[model samples]
Target chain A: MTARRPYAGLIVAEVISDAADDALVLAAGMTGRILADLGADVVRRRGRDRGFERSTELFLSRGKTMSNESTGELLGRADVALVDGAVLRERGRAGLPSVSAVLSLFGGALAESDRPASAFTAAASAGLLAMVGDPQREPLRLGGHQEAFALGLSAYGGVAAALASARPHGVPVTIRASLLETLVWLNWKAVPLEGYDALPSRTGAAAEWQVLRCADGYAVLVYQEPDWPRLKAALAEPALDEPRFATRGNRLDHLAELAAVIERRFLTLTRREIHALARQHRLPLGPVWSPAEAFGEPHNQARGLFEPLGVDPGVQAPRLPLVWLDQAPARQAKIAVGAA
Target chain B: MKLLEGCRVLDLGIITAGAATAALLADFGAEVIKVESPTYRDPFRAWSAQDEPDAMPPLFRATNRNKRAISIDLKRPEGQAIFLRLVRRADVVVENFRRGVMEGLGLGFARLREANPDIVLASISSQGETGPDAGHVSYGSTLEALSGLAWVTGYQGGKPEVSGRDVNYPDQIVALFAAGAIATALRSVRKGEGGSHLDLSQRDLAAFMIGDRFAAASQGEIVTRQGNAQHHYPLQDCFLATDGIWIALSVPASALPLLSDGLAVGDSDRPDGLRKAVAAATAARSAGEAVSFFVALGVPAAIVNDGNGMMADWGEAWDHALQRDEQGLIVKGFPLQVDEAPLAIERPAPQVGAQTCAVLAEIAGYSSSEIADFAAAGIIETAR
Candidate 1:
């Protein structure tokens, strides 16, 4: 196990954020979390209260080793330093190690000083909001600091690439991941209706695909063109037998009628019933569970997605989403890393 | 040299989740070849609407750039043999299929390891492998709802909401997470360790965002949505300006007068009044301008911008990345930059099977006669 862990005990100096000198973005913080999840000894300076809410700290600070050391002392011994571009410009990359890898999210392309604070506004400013959600209404942001999630992911990939490229030799390298650019990259992927000049307005909220109320809660139902025959079979309703529901465009045209018919049918079933039907029909439909209710989910339970956090018996550590076969230090990684 | 210059990746990803993962590796200088079959082409590949002769869709081009394309039919033994040989030479294989689909097709991790003892097989799925929901079908929106993102996203009083359009954030999350996982696995291999399967769950990951809700709920706190607010702080909120622009401010009301000299709340202690006053103040300027002003003054401010406003904020960089194709259609490039070293786009997305013969010959060491014979035997498609 010791032989397998090239990542084990890698000291990552995280130049953390605080309220007095707030220099953190949710996306950028999430980037640090990504490295921590891979078992880095993340050291954030203990400072005045963090600029973010306790929730942000709890989410970002989990799995990190907080410290009171000066940033200089920490970075001197650290293998990786996660910093935003502004920090690099101000501090210069002089103190970074010969083998050090720096994962950075650039300051705003417009005003370098204008670091984004909200995932919603950042996403919107990136043109991501423009292409997402209902086209008629103001662009809809997904629930939570999603911009953090987006940039954090790119940061995670950048850090991972940096880690993989790390060597006993070579000059320090800086990997730059963009927040606004990442948002732009993700928001428009489909063939834009407006061609390349601009992102076409998203269609209205009411589409062929949506969440419908079930007996217990809500369930998302994907009644696409491919699933029409099987969906009609599962709905087993004569109301949907109309010629209006035949083609994709017609189905969109009569989406209300179709939704009403499906909603009524769905109302009679629990989320479990819909899951079963979805599997049988090969359609993309499933229940929508709240975070609390997710604990009872059979699949999550089986996968051991959540581990006990030790503070409370009822509380569990967030289930890690990525399993590394490299740092076979983890229980799952031993078998996952093929040497078995 | 680029970080992953020597790495080779076989991407059997379908949606944004898989292509985006491969795209990351490609951007970092890995040789990532997209493996798809005409019979099972990626669902997102229908990017171009009209028959424009392989004019890639915007989404497809954005996520699938920096990699070559090849098609292989795993259903047929000959194709599987070719793919297995590719796996032997490949360092990483990434696929977004639901659990057991690969095993069912004899391309599961166990089989890949048999072919190459040091190959990392990353299975990117909505629910991870081995769970009851592992076999369940899910899209990004459904995952959003189930993962608790929907429950926490809407306004303080509004019901749980999803994207109005099918904009799934979890898919992108899975892509990056998987890419990182693959890179991690690659590091172990670089150090002479064996490769293993990476089981990444997008559903579990997206749900992890609302982990704070779990802590709050566990403490017997009834957590509801905050909309543009946080922890029920009256001052931390988003308001629509008189001119119809939206901006979010996280500062308390007490600091407002000091932050902006002209604005005065005048005992607007009530939440509604404060909101109204803030709205009035913001309405005087454009959303982008207000954001810049507040940011300059050390207040966290952001305007709710769309595609147009986004370009306005990040103009030159955005303009440089978003280029015009031969048809003058705006196309985008990879956003991640590695200083002065060029992260080369080896080629545009290959037409399915366009590189079948070439990849098989170059990577799999298949002879021309063997490739021609395989094509003759109906095991591979060498043309569109």
Candidate 2:
């Protein structure tokens, strides 16, 4: 059976549109498409003579149709506005009153402020950079516009919630999911350490958990004490039987040594074998798949997780992330990954 | 002025994923019944190992605000019977139990569907319900690792560093998606479309978040960590300002003249030179001064704030995002604002089962004596 398009018929056959600035297109426009996939009549209104990066533009427009309607005209027709702060700055909020909900995916309060609000700036301002890289080295940005998707997803909820609660007495929803705020939310588990004597020390390639190299590829493991014996059995490594690797604390004390033993054992097994063993032992382990291999993943394919972007038969371009089984997004050409 | 003022949700969440989902709905004015157990409450309640008894943890407080609480012993037949009645009245049910746990409790989707045909059942699990590894145990971090995020994070040439301290980034991600799904499902039900099960896999969501990585990986390309460097020019990376502060930016070649080394870096076209030149140019200025100077020239630039930088008040956004409880604790703000609807807790998260009698009397039509009987029989507990 076809997945249900839960958004259909709620908004008069659907009404959705986005008109974000060039820099903000990926997040705002992508959010529009996600909403559109849910049966909203989504559209992207380009600026009067402005141009955009083709892939970014196409990524946003792949499933949804496009219109050159001015920002004002689009907002007049849209039930939900997936707006960019850049549009608010350029066009002003005069046109904003018509839409039922507004999800601003850029600098919210920071839109007009001196502080920067791009994904980079937001990440920095939120102190996410403090926890991302090595303690001794400079902060590194995560690959791709990592902050954009999170911000976009939040914007979707902001807009969805607005639509859900609209009434004569209800307030129109207006959410400004600051890139800074989302990043702050991302690091919520790390309690604020502003005045603490100690800050989170970065551990470059080292983390409390890791994706270790296996004989053929990589493995994802979440170490637990009860599973140590099972892990030892899976690897059949005599070294793992020692008392030093017996308990979680002991393993921590001899982490390097334990890791050395595990790494050597992993060298003898392929990723597939490791996963099989993980399942057998109920170990919290999985293979570390590359994007290339993700499409062919047995589980994902069986679940229909990856859809061909329909870009080409030979050239596979996987669709965008943020899958909803109810309303899977439209197929698009594989995005030029890592493209700024 | 609440947008979701009439929507009623049954929050059967235990961890961050389930709780945050319900919280998002509550933030938007949904009447969320945060259902916990008297014996086995949401682990998030005593989140901090050191938290005082009966005193809620900050994380729990932040995510659980703006919702009513009802502690029912689902393991008991009477409690499950009461919950089934709630199922008939609720618009949605959000849960993150291990697979089949609900079925074991006789509260599975099929069973709930029989009770309320239009009920939206959002089931969040580690690896989705249909996958080969569906039964595998995982935390938010484990899902992060399996999704290729952990492999790609960290410094260039460095091993993958797990994202977040103890926070499972995927849990929150799943929450956002789950909320959206529930909203859509509710809309569908309004249009006469039946409610359906929403099976969201934390692992799938993680892979989707880093979707571009998969695009690159599709061609046998593995883009390792490149600290602060975008796929474009190296000049687009982060740099240190004169006063020991870090700044992040990216300027196209057309605007190269805006930088002090515009001529040299533009002409040389070298990553190392660009990095050096940008650092050299801003070496004497403080981070704020440097960023302002760039903004003045219409360049996108910002200071790379560390933990210390995140401390400043959030300005106007804070007015709508945060609320304070009677204990004077400032809870995290709802990420969204519905025009005049600034979401705040009607009552700080009801003490576990604080609303047991009110809920039972109101929804299940339970008499006061029945509530007392249940409490006496260990079927439920009410807050003192």
Candidate 3:
């Protein structure tokens, strides 16, 4: 049986946002291809000029059919339309009477509606708060392209919402997504928690919850309220008997002292030995794994989590993070899509 | 207010990395029909409370809400036949297998395109499907290391600490990108263009998170571990409140003068006074009051609320979590507008192969005898 078609094979024309970054345009094009995979009959639209990267075919045109036409011509057969950066900037400012026009030998009549349009910007609503004022004086650049990516995510939601809302309103639904908005939302929600500005600080062997430099390798030591007694008993540390080191609050207040005590206890223990002890105590524990360590980890292997790929027919790439019922993505397809 | 009321997606993926992508798709009103195996189901089906042998896991429920699940053994020629039919009707197929696994099973892009040339196919991977490192093995943690995120996420004078107890940050990043890409692609398709292939690497997605660090490194800057210490703003960091919980405070540099005048705890020249004053103020007030004081002044501040805090907040202001069972096994759902649509929560995650027989009968147009034979031959698992 075939999957249910959400829309009756209504021919639709799709257009992407032409922005400064080719990465986004390429990514958007690839995403369009994925949407086609979901059942939208898709066609690829190119910009007026080529980008700095000649690899648009490899990146964006993968899994998609190519097409060339003016925006006006494409819009005629389009029942659904996907638009990007150009819509939000000039059209809104210029105050166009209608967002779209009809193609005609002799103009019969034009149909238009002004119901609200759903827009998805890579930026979240919250992310926008940072860039409210001036780009020059108080410019807010995110630490990364997360803002842009988030906008992309929001755009997906906005497109669906707009499409959903439009049917009832009898209007041609258009969705707006921006990179700026997604970042704003993520920032507002997760706001770098503290020192999020700089490169995340690098911690070496010792973590807040686990110790890494014991034995030749590293070990994860987990301690919570339930496991503290077992840890104290295992280490035979008398300081654990002290009132100030007994409760969660007491231990936190005197964290430095407690850390020292725990360090002293761990000094004589090997990583393997400690891991065994942790297991016996039912504490959450593991090893500080490098890629090599991960390859040999029994738990991971048992889970059948690894999915190996062939970069070339002879050359083996690393195992991937996903496994599709003992299957991997098609490498030949990647080549066909011009990924290489 | 189904956000994606008219959107449709064919989810040809499994487990967390791909499930996360589909789950996010389901959150917005995209009709996602998840293709699972008849034998094992998705791996998540077996992951549940250890005590409840037949129940689906909470982790699966958290990510797989609001989507239909179907079972088909793609290895069987008939199963491949069924999938091609579905492909002809699908708008998107998001799969994150290693590499070449799809082709080996005869379910490659060629087969998919044969059914529908206009289909958009997104093959998510640990590395990518191409390049020298295309075949590298990865989990969320491994991706973190390759992307240099794990390189810089730890306390001062310590080795890199791995993050995430169960969920991987890279997986979420991929899902976010996938969702965004599909939205843009739909726009293109509407404009009479074919959808494009999105080649997103978990490594690249992870690297994007630390772009600032890479920029700094390009300029030959070495950043050392400072824990929660901020560079420019003296007192901008997570500090211990009186209640012993961590509170993140972002005091503007311009507020240094005001802070000095109000607190009177530090000297004008002693830069350490800022830390001292914050420490003092934090110690004097309760966590709530201290947060309120800073919040009212336009200072960005928040409590480092743990799982318990999360639960409490969910119960109070939003009631964001819903109990899936009588025993109060809860699943998290999306919270949009206060009075929009009633939350759409489905049954908890499926037990492995729990829906195999039903799915085969309904989606695959298979009879009971056929399903029984497949189950008997170890090709599939039967629900009953």
The 10 consecutive residues of candidate 3 chain B with the worst lDDT sum are B334-343
Per residue, candidate 1 scores C-alpha lDDT tens digits across B49-87 of 545765566567656767788877789888898899999
Judge candidate 2 at residue A96 and give its lDDT.
Answer: 56
DockQ of 2: 0.30
Best by lDDT: 1
Candidate maximizing TM-score: 1
Candidate 3 residue lDDT tens string, A194-262: 112321211222223433445544444445456677778776878878998878788757755675667
lDDT of 2 at A208: 51
Count of backbone clashes, every candidate in sequence: 6, 8, 82
Global lDDT for candidate 2? 0.65
- What local distance difference test score does each model get? 0.66, 0.65, 0.48
| Residue range B1-384, candidate 3, lDDT tens digits | 454455667776676667767766676666677777765456656554346665556556656766776666778887777677667667678888777777888977667767765566777887666554455444565565545555455445545444432224566557766654555444434434444455557765565444334434433355433444334335545556787755556554545666667668557457677777777887788777877766555454555443334334333322332334334555544422111232356455544455667656665577899878877865665445
List, for all models, the DockQ compared with the true complex. Answer: 0.41, 0.30, 0.05
Q: What is candidate 2's lDDT per residue for A220-300, written digit by digit as tens?
A: 556655666777777788988788877778776776576667777887888888878878877776676655566777877
RMSD of each: 4.3, 6.0, 13.7
